[model samples]
Target chain A: MHISLKPELLFNLGSFPVTNSILTSWIGTLLLIVIAIVVGGNFKRIPAGIQHVFEMVYEMFEGMATEVMGAAGKKFVPLLATLFLFIITSNWLGVLPGVGSLGIYETHAAAPAKDTHAAPAKDAQAKPAAKDAHAAPAAKDAHAAPAKDSHAKDDHGPVFVPLFRGANADLNTTFALAIIVMVIIHVMGIKSAGLSHHLAHFKNPLEIVSEFSKILSFGFRLFGNVFAGEVLLTAMASIFVIITGNNLLAYGALGGFIVFPFLMLEFFVGFIQAFVFAMLTLSFLSLFYKTENSEPHH
Target chain B: MLESLGINPVLMLAQAISFGLLYYVLNRFLFSQIRGALEERSAAVSKTLADKTEIEHRLQAFEQEQKAAQKKVAEEVQKMMLDAKDAAASTKAELVAKAKDAADAEFATAQKRIEQEKVAAEAEVSKHAKTLAQSIVQQLLSEKASDPQWQQEQIKASLESLKQSKS
Candidate 1:
């Protein structure tokens, strides 16, 4: 069971570093596109088949949003709906067969790339929680990188690098989503309620601090929940391997019997986290609209 | 680990851009179209329902008018039949009265003509009897010396007998 605090670098795109989370998220986006096409493409006035299912789901969310946000919710439905789909799909992406488990080994020379690639390895070794993750994949690694003798020089040899990771599991992606949500909320507040009214939400010092803290709260809440689920599943898988004396058959049995259950848990966790995030944003936005529309308290 | 898993500035911005783009594109393509189509269709359906109700109301009213018109026509036909019957009854009564008057007049006229003819016939009979009596009397006088009183008595008795016969 490997658990890293940070997402591993899958490959380099010229100068920019592409993390595994980014890859998975892109795949999630592509999947969303495909879903949109299948659901919304051959749409009719009267729906049937896949279109019916899609419309039903959309209407459900729309109804909920309208219930919460009232008339303004009619406009904000797309935002909430998109967030739910994106987060839920990306969260569930980790549960696929070989998400955190399988990957190519990134074995570049530690000396040359060490300065540029300090983020992943350095962040991993620095964190106490990442110690187990570092140790678990190191022993089972195959020498896929160019040089084998060069690995013996450093304390760390080739590390198992997964091609994709859950986007919600990465703190970076979740934080980004959180920040974007906050910015949108504030902007919408200013737009709906005027700048003075929106700014007045921070009348007290503690209120201002609390509002600012929402950035980290929103980001880490999603990141921690999803990442913890990932780590738990990985740890359970590892325990299965250790118990079965590294037998592949026993591992499968443990997975089907035990690990599979947590995967289901993770699935729920993913769905719930997505729901919470979107709903929180929706509720918060609703509040902003309410505050904006209501008479000012002297 | 929490420190490492914490938010990063650069990555947060990147994700923000990604989310924004995805939201914008999806909203434009998928959701807006759904709302538009759904709203338009519902409006059309309601409009059609309203139109249907209106047409039904009109049909009911028209049917009611047709029924009233039919009733009126039936009543007129019955009244016309009654009027024709009354006219026929009155004409029959008048024709019967006229026919009875014409028969009475014809009978009266025929009675008057019979009386006149009877009077004329009696006068002619009287003249012929007078001539026959005179001739008889002259022949008797010539035969047995002038018996005027007896001829007169015979003539009076014959005339009396003729009157009794006529009665």
Candidate 2:
């Protein structure tokens, strides 16, 4: 119900405004690092223990690369692997309790309120009504912090803005990933096929035209999946509270039944979106290579 | 205000930089090691297979050589046994013939000696008969003054007896 298109800005690092999504990505990066070190530290030639699991994951991407690129596909494994691992982990970060839930709230006086108010008109009317009931009687700071017993008895705590948001849910992260993929693909193509041959792909103006669509498709697809999932879960939680009218019952229903299933569903979606993005990149890379090779035949 | 969901260039650049960093770090940590292991494993497997085939070939050749040596020894032993049998048979025949020749010579010598001894005894007996007859004739002559015809008749009869014995 508190759906915002942009990730909330947590703090400013010099001129760079670091958002909650960036924070979550940093978490994902840290998680990946710890696992890599732990797994890499004990790396054995025989590939037993965690190394085995790591190898399986590594091999999965290798197979995808090989499927499209044949023996030459092995070269792209690292890039594809990094993409899948980072995206999937960042996507799943949304489901954590404090991830989208706890934050330093910067309340935009006009916009946030309008989004909450406009929620009913666009989608379900009662959804925002339920969110309002869940948020607080006061529009702004009542949910920001736990104040006093006098205020606690009157209403539920302050409406919180999360300090950490799902990285994939943010346009910045998805677009960045997509742009990076395109850049890598183009670079790889140029490296393999030479600059002239690579540019020949846009000989048809339509090909040039499609590149824009490609960006939208790739970035938006990932962003939509992850962002909508967060919205879906938050809405589902609010729905239960609204229906039950008892805070405890709603929390139980959200945590126990409705949200739990959706959370599990989101995990698979996260993995699948990651897989799709990586595979698409690999496929594009393979196509480039294929043409690069076939052009000689032509 | 940057629209919340709208793409931000600065943020996108930031994310790109982060992604690039992640890619570099991850490649160093995981991908390189796994790839090296994979290549090493492949090489090892192929090497093992090659060595196995080579060993099998050597074993087969060795087995063939062993069989040939065993066969040659068996043939030599068979030849030696046949030679021994032939030598033993020839030696047995020679010993039998030598014994037969010795026995024949001894029998011929014994026969000659028997014949000589028989002749000698007969001659001695004849001599004794002639001497006894002469003595009888002299005694008769003295008694009858002269008996030449009686003595001649006795000598003729003895000579006839000797002739019959000789025949």
* Count of clashing residue pairs in every prediction: 0, 9
Clashing pairs in 2: A5-B4, A5-B5, A6-B4, A6-B5, A103-A163, A142-A158, A143-A158, A143-A159, A144-A158
Residue-level lDDT of model 1, residues A1-298, one tens digit each, is: 3355687765567755677788899889888877776666666777777666556656867887767766566777888888888998899887664576545555555432423332245223322223223224533442233222222344355556666688988888888887778888889888888899888888899987877798889988998898898777766655645454453543444454566677789999998998899888887777666543444222
Which residue runs of candidate 1 sit more than 4 Å off their true CA positions?
A34-43, A46-50, A111-156, A244-248, A290-298, B1-3, B59-167
Shift of residue A96 alpha carbon in model 1, Å: 1.3
Q: Residues B1-167, candidate 2, lDDT per residue (tens digit)?
A: 44535567878888888888888877888778988887898799999999999999999999999999899889888878887887777777777777777777787778877777778777887788778877886777787556678668878999999999999
Question: What DockQ, between 0 and 1, does each candidate earn?
Answer: 0.32, 0.41
Report the lDDT of model 1 for residue A222: 92
List model 2 lDDT by residue over A80-99, tens digit each: 88999899889877766456
TM-score for each model? 0.66, 0.67
Error of 2 at A264 (Å): 2.1
